[model samples]
Target: MAAGRLSFRNITALAPMVRVGTLPMRLLALDYGADLVYCEELIDLKMVQCQRVVNEVLETVDFIAPDDRVMFRTCMREKDRVVFQMGTADPDRALAVARLVEKDVAAIDVNMGCPKEYSTKGGMGVALLSDPDKIEAILKKLVTGVSIPVTCKIRILPSVEETVSLVQRIEKTGIAAIAVHGRFKEERPRHPVHCDYIQAVAGAVSIPVIANGGSLDLVRTHADVEEFRKATSASSVMLARAAMWNASVFRSQGLLPVETVMEEYLRYAVQYDNHAFNTKYCLCQMLRDKVESPLGKQVQAAQTNAEISEAYGLQEFYQQTQDRLQTKRDTLQRSSQPSCPVMDGDIITMAIKFERREYPPQITPKMFLLEWSRREKLEQPRYKTVQRSQDRAFQSTVTVAKKKYRSSLWEKSKKFAEQASAIVCLRVLGIPEGRLGEDDSGLVCKRKREGRSNGNSEEERGKKLHVEAEASEPAAPAEGEGPNHPTQLAGTL
Candidate 1:
């Protein structure tokens, strides 16, 4: 392997799970002992369009190095170990999108083995498996387009010879590695994974070959991985659901207790802001061994990440699990007692402690919880302040819109007044009246439309006209005849 490129030191890698394999999960795997880790498979086009997906899946450092690509996804700690996998059918599209993210990853992997309908329907994933020529072209384009090494992950074909031939053909395209999932495309989780075929493919390919599938059994995952490597003769072993159950499978020290692993994983979840579904799925997997426990039921029933976290109560749960394990250890340590090597519940923890007594003391559960709590507390106020700022900004926008509306209304009223005043001036300055008529009070003028007053109804207009006529005509005097002195003459008459 070249510098800054992928090197399988431990030969244990994390598989690209669609929802479950996130940045936090990769980080957890790295901490445990995975030599290489891949992020979830992203569709080339969708990955380019959806920044929310990027944010949800990838977590970068607080600040960036000068040469860092803005789309860089992983945190500072695991940048060198993370492989970005994309699903694409078109060579142009693959090359175009590959350039967008090549600088940030250790290597770029083409997802050639997804069996789901959604993936196949899009002419990507396992759909590419049917067309090796197209796959070769895609790999060629990607290798030429970006500086990073390109790899492809594929499922096995029916025959071992055909599978080996397929790997050999793909290796000719200059892919740095080939990740072979032992099952055929039509195979499901319930089916047994065929490691014999994976071994055949590994023997065929000169490039690094990674074996994936059926390595996620909870108790036997680590053992299963060892068996898988031995059986397949693979350069590396990739884990999907197994790492979710307990990331510690990568460590040679053996598996940690589920409670201990879950607590550490939750801390990573908070630290990385993993998607809720990812968090929930991991929680469910960890609680599998404790299915009869109330905590397991509570975790299953929880709808949100916060609720799940609360139900687990990391510190309290770890304390209880550790104490129970410790009690079991004390019980076993007694020489007088009948020597039973394995106790029932916390055998995993005992195995770990017995293998390496210095393990628990190195990073105790309390220490991890305390560190996570401090970080959470520091982040809370910052989050609250951001929320407050957003609220204030929203309120300000509404206020500005309201003011604009009021100003618009006022401007319209002012313009209407000016137009009305102009019409009145035209009438007063000897311009043609054109049937313009004022009301009796002279406060408002009614314009005539086709000889009918616009302001009043027909009956009211007739009444107003009659009143105007009576006012215009000379009024008949009272029965008395003359003006001033005639008053006396009228009285005499």
Candidate 2:
């Protein structure tokens, strides 16, 4: 039971959030005091197939430096602090991808916590929970194949005994650490986090156990962090959605307004030249609390990164928000302290109250976009048929009952729709689904081959480092039989 298993000195880290967690977000988290960060879950085979291509294609982009050759998802500022996570069912693919980015990252984390159907349907993510033997084999191969540390992230089971046993077995694989999301596969974000189970697992495992879920309270984050640390006694805590809302939550002081947070994030997005969809998604999350306000309505209706910038008023908004925040802070400080040097009569206890104001209700983005589209169709009768066709296609995709496939279609459609229109209409207009043209296959092939050259040298080094334990037969745990399947298909964290 060595204390050295945990690599980072500080306990706070950012969780791997799909799409929302980008390189800019990672760097921002590190800048604000997060000890470590993780890139979102990348599909193992897809990464192996396309890593070279993604790198090669993006190399010409000015923002991506030469040092980011191996791991384009990480930046120079936090290369040593970022870990790469992947979802995979195959041991070879897992090892291949782990070795692919070992030099660029702090460690490699296998995602066993994802409850989305796309992951489970492919026998990856939480599906491995049903077969612990497979989990051990995959992890063993990764540990033996790479020079850097290997770890895993997992969801809890129904019984504490089963959960504790699952972690103990993983510990024997010589993993550096394990992060336990304190919820069952069936539990959603709103469900109560099972801290008791996290505590049980932490007590059972000798390696560092990081506790996650339900501890990130956006309004009372500092208190929540302390509570989670005290309750689980785990090595550290992982902040997922809360950090997305406010990366400054990693900083100990100051309660930043939603507008300020959005402005800061926009600056990062500009510096990174993040994809439109990802940049827009982060804005949506940041404005979750302000969606009812006038500015919020315009922000939500934005389709492109440029529209988002315009809606936010960019630098003007940043300066105004900063002034407002400073004024509030100065007033609060004045109200809290005494004015006189000496006491006269008995001091009167004054209950200083701050005024709470809610933004006025405004037309939502959905309503505005829907109305705006109708007006355009009426004004331009000639373009009506084309608009109708696009709407029908989007409707068909949404009506389908397949949750996994629907989510996939929705994202693709949303990406295309946003590009065509000036506003992101996923939450607004049910737009048309974009079809893949004849050139898609060729595009895919080129992307797959992008990073192939660099992987060749690493593959040789990986083979030489493989341990004999990777060849042993690992038995599956007899405790859990059926797949610990997800309760629903709609979830991302």
Candidate 3:
């Protein structure tokens, strides 16, 4: 709201994603542009013993100056679901984290909105918002224990009056600032954000009260900031998916080095390359839009980042990369100018700029069948063992007669039935079922149903399934089928 550079040296803040945005990503922003980086929320118990969790929270980030602030949000291992945590209700535990804050972080935050069942069982987050005294005690101790500022992010409670009352109580505890997501903890992502409640909390709290919720598009980001300025007189609004949605949109308003912001992001994210496939896989996503650009097209042609890096002569690869992007400007300028062939001597009326045909996104019948199989959990016909198991679990509803009838056949018919069932489930799932596992050829499960009109053609898909079954069946090991490989249970089964 204040020209994209509102100073937060002492006032409140807006750290958009309360979860999922890894520490490395936050650290990158701290380097690129963030007043303070909040580490991914840490379960206080895990905080005490799990370095792995701590390391995960710390990955891919370094936005802090030697003297700048880092904030650690204390949380309960609500993922465990075995206990009810009353947030940082335990003053001693809250103080222990506050002490950690004293070491290197710029500040400390107490999480009151984790929405996890385990956290709820522990009586923390929205579950504990009802108990103001516990919230009060935790904040008081945390504030008293830490030397730097303390902040709170609340996923607006279901009850407006209750939230406002809680805000008043929260303010009494001396927290420096508070942010309220417009939706209740469980309702966001699916339900629309409710901005009015944020306005109420902002009005109720004397300290900087930031409003958060829907209208997070670029236009909405600015509008929310404007709204916050008008409603509660807060100076700025936080950007969540709004900024991340189009991470570069902030550049011109002084978000220079936009490309590097993304590059740094890649550095942080490249880890967790679980299958060694994710790094390239994710880079492809980041580059998807960039590739549509002129320079991006060239970068994508490199096939691999190493090639792109070699082409650009830079190790940190990004398409339409900052360094090489300039060369494209001239080409783009030339292309934008009208190109006339001067057909029949007169300037061809409208530079019939052959609009490149974009591939139309289409879903076919087999895909529809696969979706059905996933959603309806169709039975596997070839494997009676699997059909029986599905019947016991009630996961598949194929009639017992169908299962018995299919199983009575030999390889070809049985395989056809199983493929039919899988295709049916895939159709029910309607998207793609679980991502093609590692065995898939780059998961390219393209089913081209362009010419076939008759239902009879489905038999071909069944034939392919039969081939796969034959391939997977154990070949007699000279001595003949004594026992198949013990670890052979995985595949289409």
Highest-scoring model, lDDT:
2
lDDT of 3 by residue, 143-262 (tens): 777666666667877689988888888988877767676778778555776767877776666677665554443233333445444553444455455444334322325443435544
Candidate 1 residue 147 Cα shift, in angstroms, is 1.0
Tens digit per residue, CA lDDT, model 1, 167-194: 8989988778889888889988777788
Give TM-scores for every candidate, taking all chains together and pairing residue i with residue i: 0.60, 0.60, 0.46
Lowest lDDT 10-residue stretch of candidate 2: 380-389
Model 2, 1-493: lDDT tens digits are 2224338433789999988778878877887778889888888866775343222212211222232222245555666778889999999999988877776778899999999998999899889899999999999898888888888999999899999889999999988899999989988888778889999998887788888895444224645676776687787888887788788878887457767777778866654446556777887787776777887777667765566777777855545544554455445544654432222232111211112121001211222233344444522101000111111111111111111011111111322222222122322233321222212222112312232334556454334322221232122222222222111121100
By TM-score rank, best first, the candidates go 1, 2, 3
Backbone clash pairs for candidate 2 read 52-450, 52-451, 53-450, 53-451, 303-423, 303-424
lDDT (Cα) of model 1: 0.59
lDDT of 3 at 465: 46
